[model samples]
Target chain A: MQYQATVTIEQKAGMLDPEGTTAKRALGHLGYEVSSVKTAKLYEIVLEAESADIAQQKVDEMCQKLIANPIVHNYTIELKELN
Target chain B: MKIAIIQFGGTNCDLDVLHVLKDVLGLDAETVWYKQEDLTGFDGVVVPGGFSYGDYLRAGAIAARTPIMDSVKKLAAEGKPVLGICNGFQVLTEARLLEGALTTNEYPKFRCHWTNLRVEAVDTPFTSKFKKGELIRMPIAHMEGKFYAEEKTLAELDEKEQVVFRYVDGNGKVMDSANPNGSLENIAGIVNTSRNILGLMPHPERASESILGSDDGLRVFESMADYITENF
Candidate 1:
């Protein structure tokens, strides 16, 4: 089966988010009343898998090894079956 | 001493380190490509600064995972002195050889200037030449040089006295204004728990000569040489 994994990686909580703050300040300048903002990277990975659970497990390993640095970032993985 | 200077693609400071070790310090230095596996017969290793792998994904992230890192890790495990300067520091952190991470500067800009650093601990091989609390000046050029670690890790590092240097002013005060990248606790450099691996943001090689404006950086190399002479 074909599965698509959507991995979302972002700075860990209480970590300084410079890019987020800059974007938030820019939004404020543009009249958006946002108090804060946090930025994240989303990766769409396509691969073959027996099931969504297996795909998710594989992606979790990927995140630990490469996709996310545990020191400063947290990540979430979502897997969807594809035709 | 035979030192291996690891050179990954985009490593611009390899030659600078080469000049400092081979030319200035009169040590035998070789530029080892990142793909090379063996690190035998080298007394020490220096990972020079530069945009390794074009700083893709994250600064030093890609380069840290290369094959040569395994050998570097092995070298470090053997208690060999492994120094990582600037981007090399990032690689050490990314490789988990050192704790913490170097993030984008608080100002979100590339900083290139002379930075004053206070040697916090001299027990380590890298800073052994400097007296405790001595101030040294070196140049730092990087977009992601802000040192960051979680509160628990920071506390542990402090407790273990793993922090080797802190950014300071001429008066030896660690003020926020003196912190170019807003590193946590003004940390400019740190060593691992074992104290064999040292990583710092400033370019000591750039300051190894009096003609280069200051010779303060030579003290670090000298300290490493002394340690090698004493132990190895």
Candidate 2:
């Protein structure tokens, strides 16, 4: 089966989000009242797997190993089976 | 003694580091491609700065997982001296060979300029030639040079004295204005627990010649040569 997985990686709660802060500041400059903004990276991957569970595990491993830094990032994985 | 300058697709600083090591320091240095999984015969390794893989998916993230990093890790574990500069520093953190992560700068811009750094830990092989508290100038070129670590990791770095350099003013005053990338505590460089591995945001290779501005950075490689002679 072919599964499509999307991984969203974001800076952990206490980690500094410079891009988010910059965007928030820009929004404030445009006269929009915005308190905070967080930034994240989304990776959409299509791979072969036996099941959705296996696909999720594979993407999770990718996030743990390369896509995300455990020290500063928290990643969420979404998987869908391709027809 | 032979040193290997790890080269990736976008590693533009390999020649500069090679020049400093071969011409300036009088050490035999070779540029090793990332595909070559062996670092045998190289006594030391220097991961020079450059946007490896075009900084895709975050700076240094892709290059950090290349096969050569396994050899680099072996050297790091065996107490061989390894220095990671600029983008190389990012790769080191991404590889988990060094603590902390180099994220986008506070203002989120690609900063490239000479910076003053105060030597904090002289015990590292890379900084052995530098005096304690000596201020040196080096160029830093990166968008994501801001180093961030957890509070506990920061505390441990302090306790272990792993911090090697901190951005500072010409007068050696540690101030926020001197911090180019808003690194935590103005840290510019750090070493691993064994003090064999070093990662810094500045480009010492760019500062090695006085004609280029200052020869202050020449000492960094010189120290490595001395270390290799004494240890290996």
Candidate 3:
């Protein structure tokens, strides 16, 4: 089966995010009442796997090993079966 | 005194370190390509700074996973002194050889200037020549140089005396004004628990000679060289 894994990585809470801070400041300038903003990287990985469960495991390992830095970033993996 | 300077794609400071090691310090230094598997011929390893893999994904992510880093890891495991500078430091953290990660500065600017770093520990082979509380000046040029670790790990690092250098002012006072990147506890560099691996943002090779401003950074290289000879 073919699966598409969408991986979202972002800076962990309590850690400063410069880009998010900048965006929030900019939103304030635009007259929007924004309390906070956070930035994240979303990766859509398409791969072949035996099942959705296997795909989820593979994507999880990928996030741990390479896609996301475990020290400062949190990641979420969503798998969708493809034709 | 042969040292292996690992060079990955986009490693611009490899030759700068080479010049410091081979010409300035007069040590046998060579730039090893990122594909090389064996580093048995070298006594120490220096991971010079630059945007390896064009800073793809993260500053040092790609380079840390390259083949040569395994060889560098082997050398490090044998109790050899391994020093990482700037992007090299990023590589080390990404490789899990060192604790903490380098991220964008608090101000999110590419900082290029001189930094006054106080030696917090002298136990590491890289800082054996410097006195504790002594300040050294070195130039740092990078976009992402903020050192980040979880609170628990930060406390452990402090407990283990692994914090080697902290950013300080000209008067040697630790304050927020002196912290260029807003690192935790004003840390500019750190050594691992074993004290054999040291990582920092400053370009020590760029400050090796009097002509390059201060010779303060030279002591780091000198100390590493001295450590290799005495122990191995």
Candidate 4:
């Protein structure tokens, strides 16, 4: 069976981020009063697994191995078993 | 001495990095596609500066998720040397091979100019060519080069002397105003706990030639060569 997993990674808040600042400024120019903005990347993966536990394990491995940086970016894996 | 420099779809500085390794340092080097999985027989690896994935989504964010990065990570885990410059630094942070994250410049602008840096730590193979407290000049061009880490982590890095470089003024003085990206502690570079992997926001390969106004950058690549020759 195959499972779908979504991983989201973002820069930690209070850390200096020039890209987010530029986006926030642009948004303000468009009449948005957002004081700050954070940037993140979302990745969806399709993988095969025998059980939910195994699926979660595979997803975690993916994140640590590639999907997310363990130091700054926090990641949460959402596993949906696909029949 | 085979060295592999990873080349992503949008990487811009692979050639320059290749030049530094092959021409300046007189080492055997080649550019490897990011999609390639094998990294055997290479003494060192470099993730050169450039807008990988066109800096889309975020700098280094997309490239970090590339298929080749897994091989880079595995090589780094085995204590092989990996150096990331500018955009490469962003990729390293995103990949978590090195500590901290690089944010946008403090000025909130894409800055392109010569940056002064102080050697904060010299124990790593990357900085072994320089003396402690030595100041070096290198070019920095990026919109997102600010480095940040948690306070405790920062303290730990200080204790371990892993902080490799910090921004400084022309007079060789460390000051907040000289900081181009408002990086915490004016950090310009860092290394992993083992010190084999290094990530710096400045481009050393760009400054390896005298016509570029400084050859200080050559020492960095040379030092790595020396380290590999002596230790490995």
Question: What is each predicted model's overall lDDT from 0 to 1?
Answer: 0.92, 0.91, 0.92, 0.86
Task: Please state the Cα-based DockQ of model 1 relative to the true two-chain complex.
Answer: 0.78
| lDDT of candidate 3 over B94-205, digit per residue (tens) | 9999999998999999999999989999988998899999988999999889988988999999999999989999999999999998788998899888899999998988
Query: What tens digits encode model 2's per-residue C-alpha lDDT throughout B2-39?
Result: 99999999999999999988888788999999999999
lDDT of 4 at B95: 78
| lDDT score of residue B97 within candidate 3 | 96
Compared with the true structure, model 1 gives a TM-score of: 0.97
**Which residue segments of model 1 deviate by more than 4 Å?**
none
lDDT of 2 by residue, A18-72 (tens): 7788888899999988879998889899999988888888888888888888887
Q: What is the interface RMSD of each candidate, in Å?
A: 0.9, 1.2, 0.6, 3.5
Off-target runs (Cα >4 Å) in candidate 2 are A29-31
Higher-DockQ candidate of 3 and 4:
3
lDDT of 2 at B7: 95
Q: Give the per-residue Cα lDDT of candidate 2 at A47.
A: 100
Error of 4 at A13 (Å): 4.5
lDDT of 4 at B40: 86
The TM-scores of all predictions, comma-separated, are 0.97, 0.96, 0.98, 0.80
- Sort by lDDT, best first: 1, 3, 2, 4
